[model samples]
Target: MHEWVRRGVGTVAVVLAIVSSAFATPQSLPQTILPGVGSTSWEIRNDGGTDGGPFAGVCDGSPAFGFDDATSASGAGDAYDGAWSVWINGNPFVAPGGLVDVTGTTLLAGPVAMSGLNVWLQYFFSTTHQAARILVILQNPSPVAANVTVQVPINFGSDSNTTVGHTSSGDTTVTTADRWVVTSDGGRATRSIPQSFMDQVLPRWSQQVIRRRCSTVLLETVSVRHSTFRCRARAPARSCFLPASAISPVRAIRLQEQ
Candidate 1:
């Protein structure tokens, strides 16, 4: 049943209406809640595309800028859905072992250049570090070096007046290209992307950029193979916040594709 769905978590909210859908009826829905190893959890909606996922935080933290359960929302960290690329048969491979792999084999009925590029996601909770990890398995099931553009729609929302890339306070200044660190706040949550592993995939990967506006920070990674986005929240830890504005209650950081 393709219909309009309006979902919200905390102060972040959105209204969505889909023209086409993969599930013909409510009973056909695959799964709604995805659980982590421990307290980590995710409430997701089935729509072929990574449309709905209400993630509060890694454990007890709140959603970053806001909730990212919009049409094609790739909310990572604490946004819409974590990290996802392509799918097979207009659906995702939802495995409950804390590990998920989805292939992008959906063929849109249209004239497209690179059609049916295989892409999937490996979402799981790291028992060692106690964090949430998403590994986007982007591969061309077809032989030969095929150059295609993939969208791994991982969305994230930060607190008010929060910043991305670089944020400075007092004599301390922190600059990074991987994760999201808010300016300053009482319950500010900071997430850092796996920049150390960039060199491993730079030869095949394309571009990576993180954007934030109003109350959300969206990260998009353009690559060829696979990209891993990791997130962990530390309670009572120093989070991000902006100047003048009161400390935001929450902010989530996610790594995704464009």
Candidate 2:
């Protein structure tokens, strides 16, 4: 099913205080929200040489960046579809090293070369509705099948959690390498926020996490019999704005590849 997803990357806890013989009792730090372009306009372009081979693309969908749901060239059309190597800035995310494709292995996998990547973060500032969620997508270009896992620390009140598993197995096709997977582990965290808390802070509350950085990563994991391989890419950090942007309410985000 085509699902509309809302997602953001953030840190789990706040370091409110320090303790020393000369210092006072440590105070609890407050939670933070990371900002992202919910559904604002964004795009990316893949580099050369890496063109003919398979690729992947991820994005927060559009009334802005519309997907060709019926077009075969679109990464959104199928698991392995389209060429993706673009940037939200409209410039190529130039490959740091050369593009290396990983093939044939039970013991080896890529550190595949990828560039022109983009990150989208979304947050819901209101307390009245259930519009809070996070989504992540990974684009793989290697001919060899790739496995991936994403990890994040989620903190709600006194609880802390980590991503220990995956939501689904990756999608790989011979013709293309567009993959979308979710966290099967710690994906949801909600606390019973009181009206008193909301009333006190809603008017003055800023959804932005001021002091700490909040971010998430999309990772790749490979199994090599007795040994397993894992690779991860971190998304850029941003502030989570309040009252949410009305311009584009991120319904979905996709990672595109060719």
Which ranges in model 1 have alpha carbons more than 4 Å from their true place? 1-38, 48-114, 141-143, 159-161, 165-199, 203-258
Give candidate 2 misplaced runs (Cα > 4 Å). Answer: 1-130, 159-258
Q: Where does candidate 1 have its weakest 10-residue lDDT segment?
A: 7-16
Residues 50-79, model 1: lDDT tens digits? 234221223122221111221111222332
What C-alpha lDDT, on a 0 to 100 scale, does residue 252 get in candidate 2? 26
Model 2 C-alpha lDDT per residue in residues 1-258, reported as the tens digit of each score: 121122222222211111001112221211122123132211111222122111222332211111111111111112111112222222223322322111111011112232311232111222222112222222333443332222221111111222223211332111111122222113331111110001101211112221212222221110000001122111111111112221223322222322
lDDT (0 to 1) per candidate: 0.25, 0.19
Q: Pick the candidate with the highest TM-score.
A: 1
Model 2 reaches what TM-score against the true structure?
Answer: 0.20
